[model samples]
Target: MTATSRSLSFALKSATVRSSSGHFLRELLANEHLPQDELQARQDHAARAIAEQAMQESPFYRRLYGERGIDPRILDDPRRWAELPILDRATVKAHSGEFATPEAVGRGVRTALTGGSTGEPLRTLHDARVPSLALAWRMYSWWGIQPYDDLARIGRWSFGRMDAVKNTIAWWPTRQLSLDAAVISEETMTEFHRAVTRVRPRLLEGYVGALLELADFLERRGLRIPGPTAVATTAAPLTAPVRARLEDAFEAPVHDEYRGSEFGWMAGECDRQDGLHIFSDVRRIEVVDADGRPAPPGEEGDLVITDLRNRVFPMLRYRNGDRGILRERSCPCGRSLPLMEPPQGRTIDVLHLPSGASLAHRLTALFSAHPESVRLFQIHQQADASLTIRVVPGPGERSRRHVEDAVEDLRTRIRHEVPVRIEYVESLPYTGGKTKYILSDLPAVVPQAPTPPPDTPSVRA
Candidate 1:
């Protein structure tokens, strides 16, 4: 066997114990070389298989189709597949367990919880692990990441004893080191620099917001660390400016990836970096108009995805609550996967702490400290590592003790010496009809001076 196949086989075997199935990497590699027409045919075949399996094993999907007087067998028609009803977040939230495959009831399926835009949390169950890991591996390989490579991530992670132990065993093969994204203060950045210096990982990956903050912090201090071959950003919209800044700061190419807590690794930037290539072989991705019909190419619409492999909780034509555009043209790299713009919306800011914890950590602190009277709120992190909570309260006067107790709760959760202040506001700002929830005041871009020639002496102005 070839070296690539041998390594992939070992990785697949290692992953099988934790996953419900294996043999994904081999199929994934084979699909990579398929032409666009052949890939679409395979995708349709997989989509039909998902529909049939859902009808047979999932009571929720069975009833959903039955109630509409529609036969699941009709979805077998490739052209009629688009005629199926579009599933929204509310449907999933209202009928959570109904979506899970009955066959996986006793199996150890994975659960994912994500905070929705309306402040309600939606939970999803994943029956398949192959698609996620395979898609991620494909994208990372574009940036020279391989199985068993060291990948350092900067994000919110708790260091409790049991959690740490679980992380150690789970991440041993990947050799992932976690840095706190909740706090990116001077001290936190210093420790991060130290960790990177020591580990010298080949890949740096994390939320775009935190990575941008780190890049800014490092650039401002005139500090640079080497050995990272590539940097990857996720969990937020990666604009051209942000990508440029990150590339400059890391001194490496920055690859932006698009995915969510519900569905993992939806699309990612190829080496071309022009736009994200959607994994159409494993997923049926569509940009649909408000009427749920396929939107015209280059037009922005709601991102609807149907994962072919996730049988536990079938996410067929599920609206992902994000907006993006589908490219009309193919990628220059000649990959058959369809191209997409980076998803826009649902971004949070990082709250720096003395000890590394981030993303979810700061979010937990904020939600725990949420006042009963507050209807809407936004959290902002100041340059001094202090946090300000701006709230649009309900009708009533909130007592000073209530505010103090909330502040104390936040302090207790953060477990750090940072000022937490609450400000009542009439209304909070919105970006594109959605509340930003979290905002950062730190500078993400720094101006660089031109380099002086080595042969020419610097002139005093």
Candidate 2:
């Protein structure tokens, strides 16, 4: 009958009606905090189950493992997990259809697509619901926020029909606030900060760049909005200096999250500020050198991850070309889960306008939303503030009109009548196993300046 238990009971009851986590949502909070050995046992069990099911169900894995005479049971032993071949993007692309389990797709799943480093669209069959939602709640718990606590997010969101309806009908009951960062300026931040001060969300989450922009606005205006217990930043790197600035601006602790569209959340920084704790129960993360061997201790290397949760498209030893160091040291917070430095790849430079508006919005995130229209793309920013988007056209079947729409949308988002042009290219350079999304000759550091007066007409923000 304790308050904490009561809240947990209520949260579970709420999820019972809608959760599509395959019954795992019930154990999310409990399992995430288990003792080291017990958590490892659970991780091994889930990893083995996924591997076994994938080998038995997926045409791709069945064929690969059968041809090699490898048993999926090896994963059960933990130590033998590495005997399996590292699954590369090229192989997955070549056998995309075979990677999907037809049975799981029939049971209902969503298609997750990405314009991978090579400017080629790639797809993964994702479950209808991801456990990361509950995992995020667990992260908030670290800051004394409960699962049902009011939360707010400031990021680029789809304001489509579904989200619009949710923004109205489910807004209060869900106690969630969605502050769109589709366009950012002093005017928009003024309104957003006003709303935040009114609602006083317990947890505020946003892209690092957008949050920094909002923070700058707050600082320059000498305004302080209190009452958010903590701020969570993602989508881009949160370096030491940036984290310090956000903390000072918000007057609250700032936490960093490393996530992806294909895989929900891989790691989240705890309050201790030690390092990011890998959600090892749902992901098996590894660091390897260029040769794919384990990196020397303490050295930075490529981060390869295995999806222990995704059964529809089992990501066994998948590498997305991200580089980071997987630390062996334990966290001072006493969490037994392995710690990792924030990932180093996939983060690109934000385009800073002459007006000091930084387009922290990732072009890759925008392009991925129109997967059918963008096979691959790179944004080149000239010193004159003109932008040339070098595009490799995606399939025209589902995206013929979307291509132009996405470009126009991008132009509107950048505002300032910044000259945004498109150059049709057969291919763009995707070197180093990572896409260099924005090649900007602009200076790396742009000084903060006051936003334009409210009278200045602005686009969506």
Candidate 3:
């Protein structure tokens, strides 16, 4: 091999070995076979260590806790965690640099940007080791993807020119791995089919919408690529219909990964598909009701996450715009991580009715009820119970009554007495960055009521 080729080969081999070893350790740590009490004890220890580190390192936490009149010493008791105020996307954006530890940032850390579904893009920095650990955590929990076997990643890299080098370097630890961004396009589905057949990847990972489109294309062309051992879908919402199609097309179990740019990999789906298992070791997650109190087990609430591992830019009690119910039940697979059944779509999909009560998670159900007629759709609710339903009909007779019935069903579910307007168009618009199928156009409006303040603790940095 040439000098460059030799270097690439060596890098690939080294990455594979490192990944395999990391995964082995993570699996041991996360194994459900361990006694529940033992796991809880371990988690408690890790949480304390992380909280202490944040109090010492992060300026944002130092100020936040000081203002809230909290003592960092109280971190020893996990029960006092709720005293820390929750952080949201808005707060993070407003105070990005303050969250960073000066020492960590000085060490040549990397940065990641989030094009959140709410139309706000925020950038945050992390230590260099974070991505590798994030990947290891994902491999151990989701697909069992080891270091060197060939694999394919199908999403667009947010970075432009850097992507070519990043993609090349990402495959260095594993031999025979190929990264393909072309899979995002419907027209490139044929190309993807040919490439996958050639590479015969061990794992397939990418946006759920792109994968679903490719699957539809394959189904139409009567073609089947070599089946991968595991498939991981992320980046976009995975509706029931889309997920079902992916499983059928790949002829393999599909794993859904719940992650954000801020928090690398928060939760993962196992073979059982009961619910996504939250990564309790890496991050602390809380499901809080509308009143900001802890939601009971199996009750839907906002997903609040604290990235204990990300001390360079701490994400304490960050409000992820997704909602889900925390299930107290243990998984049959024997993993000890907490379980969460994420609400199907983004928070935007939930409409607010005229009666001041917000609608629930029945939008997906409404669409699934008439799957054959609707191809793609998006719904947005305005302030006065006025709603807009945008639909992109598939190739068939456009049934006005069926479309009207679907809207009526959604209206009935959302509000007993409210009006809705349905608009059918040739194609729905894409968000300038990613092709997110669901969106909420509601303006960010914080309530005027002086709510119970977040738990405040003082940190000395």
Candidate 4:
């Protein structure tokens, strides 16, 4: 066989083996018939297995455990697992090499970059086993999507060339229905609608902004794509207003997923939609107070995650830069995983007004107001309350009139009279470190421009 064919075969076999093993583990943990204590026992066993793997293979963890003077065997207790120090994007980026397993890095495994929402991009590496476990866990718990299911697909709306190679390859195994969200033209939107109608995949997934754009198009034109079994939104936070609009248009139960490039799947919305279910099996999640100690349940703190699945590249106690509260009450859905309140906007998202009051969630409504002409845009708030809006027009003029109209719409929605300067840049700047689209920026709070992550590089408009 050709080298390409051999590589494909090896990847498929590895995915299959990992999937099988992961399914067996998931089934053991997700046994609804078992008592609560029994399920907890199984969960503890799984956590220990993952912890042991990390302790053995990961260089970062080996150093960490050595420094802490704690044996990996002592991680048998779930409570002790929480005591491990939390990590953040800065730490991961600063010490990327130390985190990876020597063998995996030497063999040239797949590397991915995260477009951090806060403009801090993180470069991450993963073996096929990492994504394999993620896919298996997702299938077993969330949608039960099998490898053979044609309907198991991914919908991506991104604007980076680095992703093109990986995305193209991934599409071969699982059908990928792609929509070029970078430039949302009339033709692109029409093509997107057509593709969605044709695919009719069981699961629909994409960024919150892109999905909402499609939903708005469908709603405005009185058009509807064939309904999928489930609609999953990620990459961007899903506000209640956007979620309501997407659910109404798609006619499917909407679920939110919280993940990072450094770490695979950290938390996701359960069927109940009450709160995000933390995947304690593959990772340890901590809600820490300002003092860096573990916050009590029902208290708000920064989210730090330690990814146990990625031994090749460990993400120990990685801070996600998201603030959320951990709810103490058990979810009605009956999953043993802990619940976290839907994360509010990121720290960089806060708009500090001249009056001293901070504004969040206001910009979402402003952007969503003009769905047809304006496809994607970013807002930067100056210290004096003057705002700079970078916009990508749908199919219309980027003239002063268009700017004024958008600004008027924003004023009406926000009920604040702030001077609006519209800059029709080619594209909004991405945080240099990551590929995520930043919706709002306060110049005062964030003095320096954020850099996009290396993998998912950004362009300046």
lDDT of 4 at 249: 77
Q: Which candidate has the top score in lDDT?
A: 2
**Pairs that clash in candidate 2:** 119-375, 119-376
Question: Which portions of model 3 miss their true places by more than 4 Å?
Answer: 1-33, 106-108, 131-144, 157-187, 347-461
- State candidate 2's TM-score: 0.85
What's the ranking of the predictions by lDDT, best on top? 2, 1, 3, 4
Alpha-carbon lDDT, every model: 0.71, 0.73, 0.62, 0.60
Residue 24 miss distance in model 4 (angstroms): 5.7
Candidate 4: tens digits of C-alpha lDDT, residues 186-290: 456777678777766657766665566566567668898786777777756776656666777777877887766567666788667678877665666777887
Residue range with the least summed lDDT across 10 consecutive positions in model 1: 364-373
Which lDDT value does model 1 have at 11? Answer: 69
Q: CA lDDT of 368 in candidate 1? A: 29
Query: In angstroms, how far off is 135's CA in candidate 3?
Result: 4.8
Which parts of model 1 have CA positions greater than 4 angstroms off?
Answer: 1-22, 128-131, 157-159, 169-174, 346-348, 351-409, 415-436, 439-461
Select the stronger candidate by lDDT from 1 and 3. Answer: 1
Better of 1 and 4 by TM-score: 1
Better of 1 and 2 by TM-score: 2
- Cα lDDT tens digits, model 3, 301-351, are 887887766666767778776677888888877777778885444532334
lDDT of 1 at 23: 58
